[model samples]
Target: TPLRKWEDVERTVSLAAKELPVTDMHTHLFSADFKEQLLWGVDELLIYHYLTAEYFRYSELSYDDFWKYSKQQQAELIWQELFVKRSPVSEAASGVLTAFRRLGLDTSSRDINIYREAWKNRTASEQIDKVLAAARVKEVVMTNDPLDRSEREVWLHQGNTDTRFLGALRIDALLLNWTVASAELAAMGYQVEGEWNDGVSGEVRRFLKEWSAKVGALYIAASLPGDVRFGGRDHLTAMLEEAVIPVCLELGLPLGLMIGVRRQVNPSLKLAGDMSMKADLQLLEAVAVSHPDLQLLITVLARENQHELTVLSRKFRNITLFGCWWFLHTESMIQELTRFRTELLGFSYIPQHSDCRVLEQLINKWEHSRTVISEVLVSKYKRVYESGWLLSEEDIVRDLNEWFGGRFAVVRQNAAKTKVR
Candidate 1:
């Protein structure tokens, strides 16, 4: 797959997945080049770019241009202009399970293989068929926000666009955003509805519940940018309060938070100057205390010139943090990252630059480790915990005790046990 047109490249990977583990190692899989690869075998596609591309793309234009166009025109000219659309959920989910089985990459819970074998005693095809039949995909998928030209201009006027682009070039960016969202949802059997505004919390919840029932969405991706936190937007809180679980029930998509880090901020600086790290911790603690079953994924970039990726790896827990790059310069960092997240992290997408051999080697290794962790450990943990045998609170305490070399137990016991019955 030489660097050719985007669609061809995407096609090559998508088709390749049928035979082997097709890993598109890129900073962002939304590029046309990336999309071609996505269709074939994009099992475990890892996105590593700022989810804010859509915002910047649309914000580059003026509001006059933005509102001047109809929704269809806006969708086409702005949102549709960038990135490959996502594969449908049903198709994508099926493709992933099918490919995994075909490749004998059964990283599902250990019990999965046992149960599967005990039940079917059938051929591989039969096994995959059974898995597909029982498959319940809860994808928390979301698109980057693409602002219209007018919107971009407002941001620009407010010093937000921060980059330059031509007229309606911003619109092209918007189109790309919508294209990715629309295509992904359509593939998964859902039509794109406009964003919810002016709806009361109850109204919003009802809408999401109905929509979830219709689309069978298990979890939807809720992208909340850092700006919102600064401005007290509280999108995550609102979603949780209003329509979170209902939407989760309707679509079966658990609420996955797509947290964004500003690209302009140096990675090292972001880490070093991270007074807000505790804020993220507080957010997680809040979610854990409130939405016990919620899944929080904090997405950040590992772009070439940023910071100490390996050092940054030890930061979060129970959160899926992503570090992506466009070239292979970050191999060492990626390897070190695997050590940090061998158990905790889900994926690390580092697309190759000029060295396909290097990328192939690195990606093969990444895919292997990712498979083991995601399939083996994650599945086991979930199944055992969900079986209602071990209390989650106790499990957390035990893990924390182990983490603290058993010191935490004495402190926790004295604090909690001494306070009450």
Candidate 2:
């Protein structure tokens, strides 16, 4: 029977959304082997990049002075200014509160020290399990950089340290800024000089092959600037065509393009200083059109690009628009994007990617996103039910699984088969 009652529809949708296990398609999160890389606890949560950006406006401290302080000191200052001095009304500030509340902690306590001590008692692995369980995250797709010596050593020695931490090869440095990447690649004993010539292209392919095999990377990804173009005759584009795309094609891996990160607007603040700008959708369109055989997973950083991206996804079968990234991760934006995506593309697009640098963030990120997703699904399902269409519990679960992470599983399975052949 159709879910005729509003209560039935709402309950069904909410439960599906909440219980659906998520596969975080993109994140900077690491495994237990790299415990130092895992950012958790209240201090890390409070001083996250989003809050850091907001902290600057209220802070009297200059960028240089702020950088001089230790992580603990920075978190203390942020807590004092952002939470204590003023109201924690903003989305980023409130997110910390949400995390605390979800984690069975005292949100009423403004004491950072208390929270820190509580967090310190939990081991990294235990916390990861707790956070994943809380987030209902099935697997976390990690952004692995082969160029980073620390990450490289881990991959070379430990391989994949955790089953939950799936790898994605991040080729941003090699593709976007070849000058620096060439120097780094050479230091790592790769013969590529970062030129667009055959020698460099071959070395790039070799590097990709090695890393892809080592980590069984699900995809090859790169974070591009807003101004990135596809049809260009430049070195970068040439490399993309000659090496990157071909390697992905050979490996049966999709290309995950995270476009529109305007790096370091305020140089002193480093990672926190990065911002977003509206990107050239035409470039994305061109890539999708040119590579009909290639599957591309794209997420633009700017909110304005959401509708256009959805429209593009509708037009191209190979292009899958996923996530409301960084600045666009707010509930309002997620609701807007998810609603627009469902209206235009049905449930074909992936609604969210945690992009969490910290493990615990998976908790609040998914919790907030799931609530918004449920709301959108309920409204959409209600409209469909009114139109005399019936959707079963099985149908809702199927859709939720696909949206959550089942699609990713299929993609990975296909890649695995291709590798076997």
Candidate 3:
């Protein structure tokens, strides 16, 4: 039914969008398995990799010299150089203030130690709950790396029991950089000598199966470079065709590809210095064309690729476009991308993903994104209502719920049924 009035549509959509519980589709955050790996506090917030890149523009400190400082020292330096000495005007800098304000801390204090003292009382789990409550996050999808020794040890010994932290198997090393990943696999007692072949493919499948079953993974994911192509005779493509895709199909899970990351553009800044390039959508097109049965959760880092990717999603039923990732997570970009996606694909696309490496970041990231999402929805609904469409409150709720997490929940439930059979 169509919404009776424009005021009713605006109020309904705005309320539904703001209050909806988000199942964050992709994040680099950790579970309690490696509690130390769970980053929080004002210092961690101030020294985020995004801010690190910005720090370079204003600081006299060389990258090599800055790298030598301890974590606490680096945080202090960033607070002084970027926050106190200059205006915290950029999006990354403003985010730290946002988190602080959300936590009921006084942002007026230039003293870093005072803010640190404020965070000293809460336990990690308690802080996680606080952040989630503030962000209205229902579930957080973690990037579980099986090759990482600390994370692997947790799985081997205790196993993850937390329902809130959903697992996603990150297979970038195995799929894209097998030489390094194979060595890590060999150390874990899986046999693989030289190039990829039948035996290695079997081992890769076994690894994915064991971990996926152990962690109850919602999906298998990887980040690929701009040059990544399908239909090649190369071993990487061979591994994808033979092992990765087959394992995903067998397990009845979606494959998540975060495309166009140009890793380590500045070796000194490490992960923070990572950049993006425009990836060939033709490769994605080839993959979708080749594996029509396979479901894909795709998010590209480059803004230029957004339209083409959405167009591709329109063409292929299997591909679902998700999130404005990393550099593209700005308000302007989110507004542009969300409007473009909504107009072109309707509610078929996911509007946002947290991608937060630290827990408290969930506050600012989701806060900023939800505002953009709601604004976009309001505009779209206004147009529809003007044309005499009667959208009920139930209609708005259902669409908002599905866009947030209901669809992913359905995918997970279907995968579980497949596993049982």
The 0-to-1 C-alpha lDDT of every candidate, in the order given, reads 0.32, 0.84, 0.85
What is the number of residue pairs that collide in model 3? Answer: 7
TM-score of candidate 1 versus the correct structure, residues matched by position: 0.33
In order, how many clashes per candidate?
41, 0, 7
Q: At residue 4, what lDDT does model 1 achieve?
A: 32
Candidate 2 structure quality by residue, lDDT tens digits, 1-421: 6666768777988998999888999998998987577777777887798888889988988888998988899999999999999989887888888888888888888888888877887888889888888888989988889888888878778667689988899999877788888888888788986346789889889888888878778899998888978777886688789998888888888888898989988887788989899898877888788987778889999888887888888898778888989888998899888998999988787889989987788888889999999999889888888887888888889888888987666655544444424
Q: What is the TM-score of candidate 3?
A: 0.96
Provide the TM-score for each candidate, comma-separated: 0.33, 0.96, 0.96
Task: Locate the minimum summed-lDDT window of 10 residues in model 1.
Answer: 162-171
Candidate 3 C-alpha lDDT tens digits along 1-421: 6568788788878777777889999998886666788888877887789988888888988898998988899999999988899989887888888888988999899899989999898888889888889889989999999898888888898777678898999999987777889899899888787766789789888988888888778899999988888888986678778888888888988888999999998888887879999998777898889987778889998988998999999999788888899999888999999999998989887888988988899989888888888888888888777777778989898988888987676655544444424
The list of candidate 1 runs beyond 4 A from truth reads 1-199, 213-218, 227-236, 249-252, 263-281, 302-330, 343-421
Instruction: Please report how far candidate 1 places residue 237 from its true position, in Å.
Output: 2.9
Decreasing lDDT order of the candidates: 3, 2, 1
Q: Work out candidate 1's RMSD over C-alphas.
A: 19.5
Off by over 4 Å in 2: 1-4, 410-420
